[model samples]
Every structure is written in C-alpha cells, then in structure tokens.
Target: MDHPASSRAGVIVSAPGRRASLRLSYANAAAWGLGNGLVSSTLVIYLGLELGAKNTALAAALILSAPQFLGLLRFSAPALIDRLADRKTFCVGCYAASALLLLLLPWAAAPGRLATPERSLVAMVAIWSLYHLLEYLGTVTLWSWLADLVPGRIRGAFIGHRERWLLVGTIVGMVATGIGTYLWRSHIENSATWNPGDRWLGYAAYALLGALAMLAATIPLMRMATVTTTASRPADHVRRRLAELLAPLGDARYWHLLLFGCTIAFFNGLTQSIQFLYPAAVLGLSLFAMLTLRSTMRLGQIAISPTMGRLADRFGNRPVMIACQAIVATGPAFYLLATSQAPWFVAGAWLAWIAYAGLNVCLPNLMIKLATPHLRAAYIAAYFAITGLTYGLATVVGGWLVDTFRDERFYAFGTTQIWGIYDLMFFLGWIGRTGSVVLLFMVIEPGAKPLSQLLRGEPQDATK
Candidate 1:
C-alpha cells in the first residue's frame, strides 16, 4: 500500500516523489499547450477563410466563445471525480475522448462532406462544443488534482514553471502552423491545378497533428502519481452535493475573487470576434502574420512568467494581478492605432497582451489559495462556471454589436470618419477593462504585501 508523505500543505508526497510528479506535470502541460496552440489559435481563421463560415462576426465570436460557454460543464467535475474517486482516470479519460472527437473536425468542415457550408458550420460547432465540454471537465479535475499535489508554499513558482514550458510548446506549435499555412497559401492554394474544394486540406492536416499532440499529452499525465483528495467525507446525497457545490459562494474572499474574475472575463471578451475578424477581413493579414503575432504574445509570456511568479510568491498574487491587469487594459489602445495602411501597429496590442502571463500564473494560485482545501474542486468549478458564462455572454454581445454596425460608420466631430464598428468596440473594451480594475481592488488576498512595498525593495514578511 502507498502511504501519504507529510507536507505543510496539500496532499503529502515525499520530496523525490513530488519532484518526479511535477516534472511529469510540466511535460503534460507542454504537450497540452501544443495541441491548444495549434487548434484553438487557428480555428477562427480556418473557419472564416478556409471553411467559408457566414455571418463572419457572429460565427467567429461563437467559435471563440463556445469553449468558455461549455465551461459550465466544469461544475459536474467535482461530483464525477468523487463518484469515480480517481481524478487521474477522469482527467485522462476526458482528454482522450476530447482528442478523439477533435479528430472529426476536419471531416465536419470538409467541402462536399456536408451538403452545405451552413451545415458544415453547424457540424463544426457541435463537434467543437462537445470537445470543449470534455476538455473543460478534464481541466477542472486536473486543477483540483494539482491543487492537492503541489504544496502552497511553492504553488506560484510551480505554476510559473509549468506555464513557461506551456508557452514554449505553444510558441513552437504556432510557429509550425505559420510556416505550414504560409507554404500552403503560397504554393498549394495558388497552384494552377489546386481544387477550391480542397481548401481545408492544409488546415485539416494541422488539426490532425493537434489531435495527436493532445493524445500524446495523456501519456505524461498517466505517469504522474495520484494523491488522496481532500474531500474527507463524501456527499452522497443530491442535496449534500448541491450544498457542497454552493459552499464557495458563502466564502466572502472567494466571492470577491469571483467578482473580479467575472469583470475581467467580460471586459476581455468584449472584442473577441473582431480581434480575429478585423485582422483577417479588413486589414487582410495572412494566417502566417496572425500566428506570428500570437506567438509573439506567447514569447512575451514565456519571458515574464517566471518573474511574475516570484513576485506573487514574495508579495502576493493580488499585487501582481493588479499590476498585470493595468498593463493589459492598455492593449486595446494599441489596437485602436492599427489601420489598413498600418496593420503592423497591432503588434503593440499583442505585446501588451504579454501582461496576461502574470494574471495567468497568479489568478489560479490565488483561487486555490483562497479555497478550502477539501472543497477546492467545488470552488474551482464555481469560479470557472460563473466567469466562463460571463465571458461567453460578453463575446456574444460584442458580436451582435459588430454585426449590427458592420455597414455603419460613426463620426466624432461630424467632419471626420473617426470610427468603425471595430474601433468602437475596441474603445469600449478599453473602457471596460480600465474600469474593471476597481473590482480587482475589491479582492482581498490574505498575507499579501502592498505593491508599493514590493517595488521599494522592502523585505517580504517572513510569515507570508
């Protein structure tokens, strides 16, 4: 029988065992990120440009936002894990199933495979939704599992380390996609003998690779050791389970974090569709250029993630998050400068997005820190559900606004063509983002030092 080793926090695993498990976890994150970067990063462009999706704005928004919408299914993770009593099995099973489902996306979108482009889009959406549902369930369980596996003291560093590898993998995958798509568009698509019906073949090849990468991710996860969950007493009854699920809401600190999360999610999502649509449709950026921009952002994340994690560890997650949020809110301003003649100006926007690395590392750390150890899964589920739904709704609303104003132009002083729908959306998004900082202020991170002190080189509190 395997006995639990002692640790200050989280499930006890011996030092050597914990180190080995974390190494495997890092590998899993890298492989998973590679798959995500290949498929999720390129799907919108593939749909709009290759698959001929109609209602471009709404379709792009739906494609981008659908996964978050399906994040509602994450709420089922806790109970399912409890019933299964094996998070590793649940996570592996979900990931494997999702990968298998993802393999059908190319078939669903292939021309002549479905009767019409509309039908193809519908099929793609259905497949994508189901894929994300399973992926989200797996993600929730994985986070819960990691919450117990990684000790609190090093949680920030561990997240940052894993994220760095994940970003590295994403960067590699995106670079490959850029190169492949560039070659395809230049040689294959423009070739005299190329068939219009086969436009999706290039994208389909990448999708296949992405699916395989996702399946490969499961291998590392399988090697990681399982730890006992903190859910001491099982809630067998429906009422008890429901109550347990709802318990996170009763915690004031977690509630504040939830509000901050919802606010950020909404603001960040407000221009989701146009972010892709404007570049591809209006500015005429190639898939290669867009992927390059995304890779640039990931590279930035790779550079800053470790520093952010250290800051969070020394000061607190909130201080780092606050600073990062402020920087990220400035991103839309950069987008506002990009015009058809100066599309490269959008590079600044991508650079500004680098700040998200801090939030990505810190936010989850804070969430797990605030949650009750035994109920971490429930708290995580609630966080994802509420924030994901908010983001999806915001994206849909933004899409509607874009569709409604696609033909109209707005003037600032009645003499200048000051704004198009995309511009308007970007400005509004920036405003919402700037305003959302207020919610961040409302969040209470225990044992956190003030940002000013951290900047002043003051020693961190020993107890923290």
Candidate 2:
C-alpha cells in the first residue's frame, strides 16, 4: 500500500524533521550520481581515444537517441508506476541488468582478434547505448517515487542538502578516477603494481559497485513501504490543475521557456562533450589532475547549495536560476582569456560549480512546483526527454563542427579556435536562457510557493 503524502513513504530510517530526511535522501543521491558521472563523462572518451574510434563514429555513440527511446517508455510509465504496480521491483531488476552491461566494458576495450577495430568499437557503443536506455528508464521510475514521498514545501532545501552530501561522495569518486588516469600513464594499473588493462577493468568494477550502492540505498527506502495495499481518494483536482497549468506551454510562454531552457541545455551539453578532452588534451593535466579539478569544484557546492536552496525558497526559483545561468553562461568565455596562469583553473572550476550545483538544486524543484502532483512524474519525464533530446542535437552539431574543421581548432598561437566554438555555444545559450527567464516572470504563479509558506504567504481567513 502506497501512502502518497506520508513523510515516511518508503524511507528506511524512522525519524522526523528536516535533518533526518535530508540525510536519507543524500545517501540515495550519492550512489546514483557516482554511477552517472562515470558513465557519462568517461564512456565516450574511452571509445574515441582509447579504442581509436573516429569523429562520426563517436557522434553516433554520443547521440544514442535516448530521448526518442523514452517517448515510447513514457506511455508505459503510467501503468507501471501509478496503475499496474511493482515499481520498486522493476527498478531493482533494471539496475541488475545495467550492472551486467557495465562489466562487459573492459572486455570490449581489449583489442580483439575476431572483430576489426571499427567493429569492436561499434559493438561497445551499442552495449553502452543499451545500458544508458535501461538506466534512464529506471532513473525516471525511481525519481517518481521521490516525488511521491517528499512534500512540496521543503523540496528545495531537501534536495539541496541531499546534493551536498552527494557532491562530497562525487568528489571522492572523481579523485579516485584521477588516480586511475595518472596510473594509466604508466605501465601499471591505478598504481605501479598492476598491468595495462587494469584501468578499464577496474572501472567495470566501479560500475558494479555503483549498482550495489543504489541497491543498498534503495533498500532503506523500501524498508518503509506499506505491507498492505493502501488506497487514496483519487486526486481529480490534481488532474484539473495539470490541464490548466500545462495550457501556458501552448501560448507564447511555452516557446519562450523552451527556447531559453534548450539554449542552456545546449551549452551545458557542449561543455560536457569537451570536458573530458580538456583535462587530457588541452591542460596537459594528467587524469588525476582533472579529477582534482572536478573534486575541488564539487566540494565548493557544499557551501553554495544551502545558500542557493534557501534563497530560491525565500525569494523565488527564477532569480536564483538567473544567477546560476549567469555563472554558467559566462563562465566558458573566461577560458579564452586564460593564459598559462595558475588562477585559470581556479576561475574555470568556480564557474563550473556555479552552474552545476545551481541546476542540480533548482531545476528539479522548479519542475515539481510548476506541475501538479498527479502529473509530476510524467511532466518531469517529459522535461527530461526534451532536454536530453536537445542535448543530443547539440552534441551532434558540435561534433560536426569539430569534424568539418578537420579537428584543427587553432589557427594561431595563444588562440583557441576550438575553444571559440565552445564559447559561441555558451554565448548563444545565455541569450536563450535569458529569454526563458523573461517567460518565468510572465507565467509566475503564486500558488507554487513552498509548503512552509502556506501559513504566512496565503490568505489567513482561507485557512479557517
């Protein structure tokens, strides 16, 4: 039996207040984020650079066409999550399969005798694509549970606290990854004591570990599940609210929002694509150094998150998002200005976190608030699908730009021709985001205020 609004909804720890719930959520997020970072940041690089795959091949791998895949998955979600049942079991099953796919990565990385270089690389990409699709579906399903469990009022602070801890774990994981890279430069695995294939093999092990971590965290959540089939009065009003809420998307507000949001999505994706390349190629930094950068930036989020969360709750989600967008949109442009100075790394890393933590804390909260509870999961999925598909389009365009130019980004010394490509992405994305910011002001609804505000922010007589 699922109790939709109980604070204890499937949460393992039997406790009260904001702090305890925050801890429980953080544990869950850390496990999920670590697994995701490993797959997204490293998978493409492991293919193109390590396996020697070419530009177009890499683009296809990057595309993976996940957005379209989820559109079909969306149809089945209602029954599986809301109607048919067994969402938890389904999530566990998906994780198990994903872990299995991960273990194959090391074997695929091995130069094979049966398959040609191209064929082996293609097979590996296919495996990774399948893994991502499964993971994405599982994630959407899992996220639905969180939305059902957490109340609307504290969502911002709740998620912020959760991300703070997760960022800490992410830092640890990133540091470990950097160590693996540094060791790879030598004849040994993560250190001088191992063999050449140790790096990828060890990574496969990390993937398995990630799945196990998710299970560990989820069990705590599931421990709190109801033993009997519980029922609720159907939320008919919620449905009515959704129809009204989504109506704005059909008007000018929708285009304005989509254009701006997609722009932010595109530049963010571009940075993501080039991120692995920068550490290994441009900075002349060892994999370890890159990890250090990732860790340092993420660590900063610990302080930034609480501040950002409360500010969003106190002021508004829009202004906080604008502040974040500025840091992110303008951040990349700083790279071209950076010389061989030591502070360059510090500057870029700060800009990166401003975007990273802000988005993580705000976007999910904003989406949840904007949509009605009945439609929350579906709306969130739709949001993810749009952003992800846009991400695919952006990555493809960037890849083409990189390829058509012969991958020779530099025409002059002290100038980053390729870096300029990345900068233009941010410049345009900022304009796009600014447009969305403008829309938020128009469609802003007072009813979306946090739960804590219910007593103060609402009309007092209505409370009676």
Candidate 3:
C-alpha cells in the first residue's frame, strides 16, 4: 500500500559496484541469448533447412508475429506479476520452462512414422510460439523489478551498466553459439547443402547448450534480490486499477512521452522486421554470416550500453533517448549504400543495433520515473503491448516489401533497387521514430515533482 516515494526514499541501499550489477545482468542476458540464439536464430534456420518450409517470407512473418500472441497473453501478466511476492520465482520459473520446452523441440522438428512431417513442423512452430509467449510474460515482469529496486536517481547508470554487462553476456553467448552453429552447420547441417541427420544433431547440440545457459541464468535470478509483495486493501486495489488504466493519459506531459515512445517503437518494429533480410539479401550473407553480423553488432551494444545508461541518468532519459533514436534512424542509410560491401553492411547493422540498445535501456528508466506508483504495472504492460502490436504487423509489411521487389535487379532499374522495400522501410521507420522525437521535445520535459502534484489538479508543465 506504500507509495514508491514513501517506501523507497529512506531505504538504506548501497549503489552496488558496477562489477556486481554487470556480472548479474551479464549472466542473465547470456542465459536468454544462448537459448534465444538457438531457439530464435537456429529454429528459424531449422524451419527452412530441416522442415523445408519454402515460404521463407511467410515463415519470417509468422515468427515475428509470435510476439503479438505473446503480448496478448501478457496483457494480464503485469497485473499478476505485481501481485506475486517473489519476482525471482516468476522470472526464473518462466525462463526454465522456456528452456525445457526448447530442448523438447527437436521432437517437434520432424514427424515419426505416426506423426507426419507437416504435423511435426506445425507442432514445432506451436511450441516455439509458446516459448515466445512465456518469454514475453516473464521478461516484462522480470524487467519491472529493476524499476522497483533500482533508485531512479541512479537508474540510468545502473540500467546502462546492466545493459552493457548483459550485452557482454549476449556477445559471449552469441559468439560461442555462432562458432558452434558454424561448426555444426559446416560439418553436420551443411549450410550450402542440407542434410537431415546433421540438422537433427546440430539442433540437439544447440538445445544442449541452450539448456546449459538457461540453468546458469536461472541461478542468478534465484540468488538475486527478491521483490517482497505488499498487501493491498480492496478499495485501494479498485482505486489503483482505475488510476492505472488512465494514468498514462492523466497528464499532457505523459501524453507526449507515451506518444513519442509508441511512435519510436512503431518505426523500430518496421526496421527490426527486416533486420535479417538486409544481410541475407543486400549483402548476400548466409545464416552463419547473419549470426556473425548480429554478434558483431552486440559488441557495440556492450561498449555503449553502460555509457548510454549513465548518460540517461546524468543528462536525463529524454535527451539520451533522442540521441539514441537519431543514431538508430540514421544508420540505415549506410546499409543502403553498403549493398556491395559485406563489412560495411555489418558496420551499419552494428550501429543500428547499438542505437536500439541505448534507446531501450534509457527509455525504460524514463518510464519508470514517469509511471504512477500504484499503476507501474499498467504503464509497463501498455508499453510492451504498443511495441509488440506494431512488431507483429511490421513483419508482414516488411515481408511484402521484400518479396514485392526481391528479384528486381538494380541493373534493370538503372541500379539494383536495394532489395525490395528496403528503401521504404528506411524511410518509413525514420518517419515513425522522428515522430517520437518531435513529440518528446514539444511535449514532455523532466520536472521532478510528486505525482500528487498532478493529482491535486495543478497546472501542467510547459509543452509549447
């Protein structure tokens, strides 16, 4: 029943060493990446390589769309998570379940004599979607904990530091995964040419490593600080619920922040939808090449995430976020020109990746500060829903763009059109993200005053 200010203000907490937080976040990020690299990156390859799903474009859309279903389930998860006394339980439990499901997925890859290959593939996709759903539910809940525990005064630094560490974990997990996948791909799966046995073996290897990382990741969350639940009065719960749903729009300032954030996410969705397509098409990279490029991009996130976090904490989340979006929006032009140069395309990809990481790390801190105390869960859930919904549909549009002009040779058009709707994505994505920037500057400004100030029906902050 206590507000964040009342509960958190006098709490004696040490700003832990960068080392400790980084290590924990790294371990956590690694567990997911190891599993994700296998589940997401590898399974995607598996669909094409093993199941022989020739509808790569459709398959891509379906995979990206998985989160929409997950988000739908997560619509209520924030409510439940906030009520649960132990975040570690939900976070670790969800991750463990996802890992277990992933390990069992090899069975879903191919049909036995009893189950047809088509049936098996469908089952595999279903299981994978379940995994995404679990991940979405677990992750949003787990992340809200950081907002709860870390003091907003130091949040940007802490989160940035955490992100950098996690990026390290991601890099380590991804690099190891890429090498293993490459080895398995070349020896067993045969990327240039396909082999079913090699694929089964490769998938198993990926699953085993993913399981191991999951186990390791689970350790820290179990060992980490717990969020002890507080009791709520019945009337208070109802009042809170009403407040939660409307808080984001209760103020003109928040209207801008939320508007800007959602806009940015809309663009990000469009860009991320085709993130894989660029390297695969414009640069003509293979699956291994795709993984390697992505891993390489994580290196930038590792280096800059903490810095951006610190900047967010010091300079404020809005400015840092603006910078982040600018960097993200502008990076695509480099990719457009790097069509002939693989390394340049990778560099552009890395820059975009780094910008996205910075934006993500900082934006959460901004929201944590802006959220109504009784309604924190609502704010978090709303953000995810907005982003997830955009991402789901973005993939379909992104796929259509690519497929529509996929085979249109540049020479035929006076220059090879940069692979389908790549140019349009760059343009549209920037437009959407820039909308965020304009909304933020014209509307929201950081003025530290209690929510009670607004609740008292005081005049709003400057937005003109």
Q: What is the lDDT of residue 312 in candidate 1?
A: 84
For each candidate, give its TM-score against the true structure: 0.95, 0.76, 0.80
Pairs of colliding residues, candidate 1: none
Scored by CA lDDT, what does every candidate get? Answer: 0.82, 0.55, 0.61
Residue-level lDDT tens digits of model 2 in 1-464: 32333533333322243334445557766766565544434534543355545664234426344333443454344445544456666655565576567656556656552266666666666666666666666666666556655555656677788778777667666666556545555645446476554445544455445545544545443443322224343567456445533543554533444555666666655555544554455555555565566677788887788777776666556656766765655555454454345425435744465566777787777666655444556656666667777776666565565456534444333664544454454445445544444544443433444434543653211100
lDDT of 1 by residue, 39-113 (tens): 864554465456675777887778777878888888889889878758899999999999999999888877767
List candidate 1 stretches off by more than 4 Å. 1-4, 7-10, 229-231, 234-236, 413-417, 450-464
Query: What are the clashing pairs of model 2?
Result: 1-230, 153-451, 260-432
Of 1 and 2, the candidate ranking higher by TM-score: 1
Q: How close is candidate 1 to the true structure, as a TM-score?
A: 0.95
Ranking by TM-score: 1, 3, 2
Q: Which candidate ranks first by lDDT, i.e. highest?
A: 1
Give me the runs in candidate 3 sitting further than 4 Å from their true place: 1-6, 9-26, 42-49, 82-86, 111-121, 189-197, 229-232, 235-243, 249-251, 271-273, 340-346, 404-427, 430-436, 443-445, 448-464
Rate residue 39 of model 1 by lDDT: 80
